[model samples]
Target: MTIALEHPVLHSTAIALPARFQASYTTRLVAVGVDKRPSDFWLETAGTPQAGDVVIARVTAINNHKRVETPESRKAILFEGVLVMLAYGHRYAADQFLAHVPEDLGPCHLVAAGGIAGTVTALHDRVDEPTEIEPLGLLTNARGTVNVRDFAAFDNPLKVEAPNKRAQVIAVLGTSMNSGKSTTLACLVNGLAAAGQKVAAGKITGTGAGNDRMIYHDAGAHSVIDFTDFGYPTTFKLNFAEIRALSVNMINVLADSGADTVIVEIADGIYQGETSRLLRDQVFQEAVDHVVFSAVDALGAKAGVQELQAAGLHVAAASGVMTASPLATAEAAAVLEVPVVPTFDLTNPEIVTAVLTDHA
Candidate 1:
């Protein structure tokens, strides 16, 4: 049992207690359910509550009719945690317990699951959302190229292998997290697919909810996969081999699915952590194809190139913040001995060829 918090992982809090009624489960029950909320049977377990037990719990309160400046009508859920309404996803009516969630990057308002207690359970399926890693069925047809429920993530509307053509694999590497790695991949996929290339995309890092894949699909990628695609509640405590093997397996799977170009999105910076970082090891360095360096500015971009190339790898293209100005892109590329691609929307399709063509 592991929980993802504070960017780094803390195994200490990931308790795997066999919750028994009035035993180990007592503390959790007292901490979870309270107030006028309906007492649920399916949400609560009689004996020790396990990880996947659906508990109809309320959040501790904030103030009533709380005012949020963001205008994304939200209320602090008692007990569960916080629920945030992302700009995307199923629009909930007021009846939805976690209704007032926002459309931005904030904490969840209600962190617990709601439903009749003792609804149903199998050997595996259970509760979710930042806690248990139970794979549940999607109530609605997933709207995007990827489907993430609990810890299980998979490509939505699976792609069939056509014409006996092998899937083209393209792995995107960034200097760090939130550095436009996915944004650049989205652009690349658009360019490649528009040029008649069948694109399959996925992310390798164990962070970020769905920001990376949203554009990857909107930009024209066919199928997308990420760590969430696998049954991982979060990427915490995983070893380097786990990350590498997961990346390799996802690419291989996408390749088997017959993608002309399987775009792999690497989460976090190349140098972020031992478990998620790929650039720190020599073996991992030799396994990758092209490295798409994403940084904040010209100087940061230049620094990333030197650090990566010094590890004996080629810096394929530079992207991210400097995409607005070709001059900033050109300066970083010159310093790193690679071409610069700064467009966020796949404006130039030829850029993919410059980085991937064997003619270098």
Candidate 2:
């Protein structure tokens, strides 16, 4: 079987294992015990193991976002090499995994860029099928078991206290993943920084990945962070309490980092599992001074605004792919009764300043 020896997750953690070992399927275990902590799994050459178990696997194919994170924060080719990834048991908006692991060594899909191991159940028409890989074996230790959580970085509660007074929080919420939340945040950061304001950016939810944070940094954010900084491979189906605490701590960190303004990106649609629940939380709502809504289309824009309004949150303005089309922006602006700012205007400090000033 092919072997993948390069993955950023391994270098980020202290978990060490033999160069190689036997491979098997335990996706069902991860699915059933979704609530279990990552460190609680048994990574052995022989034992009853569950999902979230770290395993060394070899890439048999490549597709979208065909590069993996390297230890130096650079992207590396993911063709035919050994890598460590989390055994993901949950469904995604794009693809999903089989309920049980395959009985024998075979091909499976990389369901997420964060290195979630699973079989693809479906695909969006725009993208090709997922990259395929073969689980070579569990990277065993002297005790003969390997676990992904062992090498996981930031696998502990954030030690920050909620700020007594938070800097103005400009939160970016979207209609769906890839609907332009990160881009909007980047534009906001770039513009605010250009205007001589200290901007701290954060991704409060979603799978662990450094791409969004990198974008924010490049856009001139004074500092950037994500849920991965708190030890989660992906935030899918995470408990409400932990997720809420994470949001609070994230804001606190940015606020305390000497930021005058903080732009936090909330992943997925406003109605998405974590996003929806978070919007409804008093603590979460109280931390935000302004809400920037993003959507792919006019209908989505209207619906997003209505969702937030229903949750007693006021939207500052609308922006995203829908704003890319003048007709769609006009329609959404009429429906939302709010300005529909295009991506370009998002980088205009005056435009953002007016939006905040008008709302303030």
Candidate 3:
């Protein structure tokens, strides 16, 4: 094999590689190209690669502060391993890929734990710079350039069906990331399970991360899915049609999974482009039977609730970081005219029963 002996093959669960490519590789054959863009690659490495196909690249840079999220929600712990990143173009975030995949296989950055690869053009002040990495070579052999699309769930084609009325959907929205959307959904899943309802939960938007899915599983959800399952590393750049199709397909998948209730979470805030668009879609709105908005403070909670109400979604309850503070919860509840359930009380099966029963 004529591959460069630069980086070792360090498999990261972030990309689902074929069994053949799982072995230790000192050197391997690689057909390099310079025209493919990052957005051209899939999240998994399981398919035949044509001239424009994207392959899994072994990122050589490892920064302690920048860790990759594994499929099971475990961190790859950068210092000890090489990061496998997906080279793709991002629309909403600060980083993006060069117009074309570099034939030289030079340096790049692990822009997202979900294995998004690109050059860091900009970043929020709060986050450390993206962990830099090198594109050692395309993870490939005699077959072709392996692409993330090979292992994607949508490989089978996601045909969206009408809303499944048999299963009630509890859509959880948040004012922003880290606003306790995952926590609230986990608690609600636990509570619903305790109430003897088989629950299926999924994170519909945002970047691909197993942490939220793991939370749902730990909360006793019978099944959990996310946008990653639909072949997207992140939902930031997806068009409204694509987002709408993925959202509807995800809900239907959960409903078909035999879940008595489906708990769906749309990442980011109501004001986010994708979130706002989905909220405004009449069909998407109909797919959701109940809405629980999460926020950081009383004001955010009130605003989030108003956003939902204006979109024609009935805000069932307000929860999240605000609920941690009794005063904030009370204030939000008063203004929003909705019960503010604290995180600790979320597991109380009574709360789940009350909400579901009331909605029923």
Winning model by lDDT: 2
lDDT of 1 at 64: 24
Q: Per-residue lDDT for 198-254 in model 2, tens only?
A: 999999887556678889999999888776565455666667887888888888878
Candidate 3 lDDT tens digits, 1-360:
111223233345223232222111101111122112222322332332222234445546565236665444566566523434353435244222212223344576666665555556566766665676655455443344554444456432445555759798889998887799999999999998998999999988876566788889999999988876665666776667788888888888899999999999998778878889889888888888889888999999888888888889988888998888888888886887777888758799998678656744
Is candidate 1 or 2 superior in TM-score?
2
Superposition TM-score, candidate 1 onto the true structure: 0.57
Candidate 1 deviant stretches above 4 angstroms: 1-57, 61-168, 275-277, 280-283, 358-360
Candidates in order: C-alpha RMSD to true structure: 14.4, 7.4, 7.7
Where does model 2 exceed 4 Å of error? 1-43, 47-52, 61-65, 81-91, 95-107, 139-163
Local distance difference test, each candidate: 0.46, 0.67, 0.66
Candidate 3 Cα misplacement greater than 4 A, ranges: 1-54, 58-65, 80-106, 139-145, 154-161
- Give TM-scores for every candidate, taking all chains together and pairing residue i with residue i: 0.57, 0.78, 0.78
Ranking by lDDT: 2, 3, 1
Q: Write the per-residue lDDT of candidate 1 for residues 258-292, one digit (tens) a residue.
A: 67777787665656554235665554554455667
- Candidate maximizing TM-score: 3
Judging by lDDT, tell me the better candidate of 1 and 3. 3
